[model samples]
Target chain A: MAILLDGKKTASELNETTRKRILKLKQCGIVPGLAVVIVGEDQASQRYVRNKHKLALKLGMNSVIKEVPASITEAQLLALITELNQDTTIQAILVQDPLPKHINEQRIMQSISSTKDVDGFTAVNVGQLYLNLTGNYPVACTPKGIMTLLEKYDIFLRGKKAVVIGRSAIVGKPMAALLVNAGASVSILHRYTTEIAEYTRDADLIISATGVLRLLGAEAVKPGAVIVDVGQNLDETGHLVGDVDFNAVKDKVAAITPVPGGVGPMTIATLMQQTVDLTEWGLANGK
Target chain B: MAILLDGKKTASELNETTRKRILKLKQCGIVPGLAVVIVGEDQASQRYVRNKHKLALKLGMNSVIKEVPASITEAQLLALITELNQDTTIQAILVQDPLPKHINEQRIMQSISSTKDVDGFTAVNVGQLYLNLTGNYPVACTPKGIMTLLEKYDIFLRGKKAVVIGRSAIVGKPMAALLVNAGASVSILHRYTTEIAEYTRDADLIISATGVLRLLGAEAVKPGAVIVDVGQNLDETGHLVGDVDFNAVKDKVAAITPVPGGVGPMTIATLMQQTVDLTEWGLANGK
Candidate 1:
């Protein structure tokens, strides 16, 4: 049986460290703050926002949630973002996904200040991340969290063959960038991939974020490969599952992350950690 | 024998198209303009800038060359970029690479407006290209030129296995992005990559930009794979050579790009094309 990469426990440990950092910042007369703006009444978005707010407050940071109507115009939303951009108190800004049908998501994302773009969706941040630019820039949360997990587990990535099974802007893309920066030979496979097994069979590490349940199985993965499943899918019984057929692959793989308790918690933890990091960075830069 | 992907002929065709577009823009009282900035006395850089200026003028466009001293500070260079950014007549900006050791290249790159970043080295432009954002944004010249070459040869990329050697921001990185955006399963190899042949042996399309002489030979590549050589290296005999051993692999591959007349001419052609594109986009947006 494979050792489970316990994301929940790791997240808890990270949250404790974040709490200490927040306290230190407070001692230095800096209060870390995050502003989360959500347009429309997406239940999932609301739940996510609420959870983030709770975590921020728990860590003794300032958290503000801005709720706008579903009928909000793109111009108005952009104006709001501009307002938050100039607000010195807010170190990080996050706009929840799935805005109304009429609004251009990319435009809204681009409007956010790169300095305060904690979600790391802005073109400037994404580009810096892709190019491995050295400096203070927030990485996309999930990938950052995944990297932390890998580091905590002492998984050395240098010279390793890593296969990332998605090409999403949020998870797979940044995950590949992070892996490549860490000196790993990375291959990105997506829906257009004709034979994913050709790449995965030789991979030392596999990260799947395709949102397709049970997409990776025991037969497809090499023995002793380390798996990190970033997928969140609903099974026929409405139970959350990962891309890996965990039970079938557990005995064959060296390590793996579970669905609900794995990448999910680490993402939240990284968000909280980055929020504090932004505040410290802003303070140091005299912003 | 494999068919040679004649980049010289294709680049000429593209230049002809660009020249016609410039005429149409001239009819509309809008002259496409480009500002080339070179900060040092590098001989190769001088040659490249001269080539670009010649092409822009040949296509009947306004071209301005700014030659600054090698000792110019980062701030002064940035101010020059700012001046060019505000110059209404200059629709595109190009900064010759390998700036002085004292100046930070990325900072100067970021100072240029995204709208005028014809080189597409700015983080905003690079990010947009990585994410495959829609609308009008100039792509990195060499990669964009390579794509045009592929299209001219009617080489479809969807579902193809493409391997990009080297990870330089100018060529290899953007090449991977362009391939991934075109629905190719892309793998990026760098200095840390162990056993590069393990990936190259299965690639349907191989793009080598490592600047290493004869890096990709017949022994490393599979039979009938398409090759695109982006390397420019001086051989022991003082002749420019590509990373591929053309004499060794030409008979085995279905198609390949020659070094001198291949990616080189296409790059200059694409720069001219993008200059016209920027002018047209600016006119449409009333900039």
Candidate 2:
């Protein structure tokens, strides 16, 4: 049987570390703050924001949720982001995705200050990640969390043949960057790929972010390969599932992250962890 | 026998277009300006800068070569860059690589304004390329030139398996990003890579940027694979050569770029092309 990369359990452990770091910062008269700005009433976005807020509070940090109207102009949102950028208390800032159609999403994402860019969506931070520069910089939470989990399991990344099955700015691109920085030879596959299995079958590690259900099965993957399913999909029967066919590939794979208990929890935990990290990094630079 | 992907001929064609663009700009009362900042008296660096200056002038653009002593401090160098950045006449800025050991290179590279970042080394521009954002942004020249050459030869990138050897910020990293953005499955290999052939043998396109001479030969590559060599190394006999054994692989491959006549000329030509592009983009944005 494949070793379950229990993300839920791992996230709890990470949250504990974050909680302690927050305590340390508080003792020094510093409270790490996170500001999550959400435009429109996206239930999913709201739910995610609320969870983050609750977790921040639980970890002894200040968290603020900025709920804006769907009619908010791009300039107005940019002004708001400017304010957040200058706010000394807010060490980390994140604008929820899926802004109204009128607002330019790329412009808003790039407007966040590189230092307080909590979600690490800014081009500057993305560039730093891509270059693999040795410095303190926030990365996309999901990919960062995945790296943390991989490290926790003592996974060897250097010189490995890995395949990242997506090209998303949020997940796949950053994930591939992280893997490459860890010295893995990575191939990023997307919708245009002719034969996904041609790459995946020989891959020692496969990270699938494509929201396709049952994208990989036991027969498609190499035996003993490690799998990380970043997909959050719903089966026909309404069961939450990942990109990998867990039941079919479980016994054949070396390790696999279960959808519900895996990447999702770690992502939230990493966000809180990075919030404190940003605070510490700020303090180190005497901000 | 494989066809030669003649970058020298392609670059000349591109230079013609760039010259025409410069004429158009001049008629409109605008002169595309290029600033090549070189530090120290390194012969090779000086020669490269001279070539750039000569080319910029020959192409009908304003060219400035700023040379400083090796003893200059980072602050002093930055101050010079500040002046160039503010100079309305200057549209593109390139700080030559291999700055003196005392200088912190990354800071200097980052300080270049993204709009005038001709070499596209800044984190913002790299991020833009990595994210495949649609807008006016400069990219690293060698890779951009390689892309242009591939397009000139009508080489299809989408769905092709490409292996980019090396991960240097100047070449390998940006090259891989370009290939990925163009819809090719790109695997980046570096020193830590265990088996270079493991990826290269099956690749439809191979871009070798590793400075290792004769790194790829006939036996290791797939039949009829397209090869783009970015290496400029001296062989054991002190003859200019590329990473590939061109003679050995020429007949077996579908197309190949020769050592001296391939990537080198394209790189310089692309730099001139991008300088004009930056000027046009800046004007459109009312800069």
Best of the candidates, DockQ: 2
Query: What TM value does model 1 have?
Result: 0.94
What's the C-alpha lDDT at position A211 in model 1? 84
- Residue-level error in angstroms, candidate 2, position A113: 2.5
Per-residue CA lDDT of model 1 for A53-135, tens digit only, reads 99999999999999999999999999999999999889999999988989998889889998898978888888998888989
lDDT score, candidate 2, position B177 = 89
How well does each candidate reproduce the native contacts, as fnat?
A: 0.74, 0.81
* Candidate 2 residue lDDT tens string, A104-214: 899999889888987788888999999887799999999999999999999999999999999988898999899989999888899888889888999899999999999
- Residue-by-residue lDDT tens digits, candidate 1, B1-287: 88889999999999999999999989988899999999879999999999988888989999999999999998899899999999999999999999999999888988999999998888888899887899889889999999999999999999999999988888988998999889999998999898988999999999999888988789889998999999999999999999999999999999999879999999999999999888988888988
Tell me the TM-score that candidate 1 gets on chain A alone.
0.97
Provide the lDDT at A145 for model 1. Answer: 98
| Every model's TM-score | 0.94, 0.94
DockQ, model 2, C-alpha based: 0.77
